[model samples]
Target: MRALKLVGKTLNFEVESLGIIEWYIHAIISYQIINYEVLPADTKTPIEVIIDQLSSLSLSIDSKNLVSKNYFQKMKEDKLRKIYPYFLKMLNNPSLSLSLSLSLSLSSLQTIKIIIILDIQIFIKLMKYLKI
Candidate 1:
């Protein structure tokens, strides 16, 4: 949870984007979850642990795929591929979706927008066949 505590000090750091902070938080939590916990963090153990701990507010296909790929490597040592399927099953929960959908709708906090946040100007020559 040391990484989670750094949320307050994020502005103090020289990071490029909020995503960098987010990545660290997720990485730390993933490291923890792989170590085995005592009780149900969610209705299913690790799934709830993941969403609550990692703030996985949404579960897009890419999000699910990315998470699976990440854990796949760690779980490979145990050769217990079953955990991946269990994780996916929890992500598929309809109730979980309903609850997760209630998450705060704050404006994105990305520290860098468009890398340089520039205003680009475009000049166009009129085309004969194009409508004005």
Candidate 2:
């Protein structure tokens, strides 16, 4: 999870946004697969605060829920549904972390499907910017 920590550190997201997403990710990770001890820490523990924050973020992501707070609240209770399916696939197969991350990074060259896509464009830009 050291890698996740580094990535989290480098991310330029706002503090509030970071706090929100990090919590849900941690809780889902802890609940479905592993706990924080086995992974990296980006924000809080006990994880409830983060889970609570998720309700707000969901409103922005899913417009239909924007009308009522209850819609987003419901999503928070069902954490697994919020996790992108492709990400879970990657989590299920540990050997694919590098390959999956690399593929996500090259999304412009190839259409990404059936895989959880995250940070691909940002990764590509960072690599070029750093001359790596």
Instruction: Please provide TM-scores, in order, for all candidate models, with all chains considered together.
Output: 0.21, 0.22
| Tens digits of per-residue lDDT for model 1, 1-132 | 344225324423222211211123244245336533322323334543443432343322343333543443343322232233324433454343221111222346522122111112210111111122
Superposing all C-alpha atoms, what RMSD in Å does each candidate have to the true structure? 15.8, 12.7
**72: Cα error in model 2, Å:** 38
How many steric clashes between backbone atoms does each model show?
0, 2
Q: Whole-model Cα lDDT per candidate? A: 0.31, 0.38
Worst 10 residues of 1 by lDDT: 117-126
- Residues 1-132 of candidate 2 have per-residue lDDT tens digits of 344445545764211111112223434444434422233333322345434444434233332323355543455433534343313333344443333323333445654332222366755644554455
Cα-based lDDT at residue 52, candidate 2: 46
The window of 10 residues in a row where model 2 has the poorest summed lDDT is 13-22
Give residue 117's lDDT in candidate 2 (0 to 100): 29
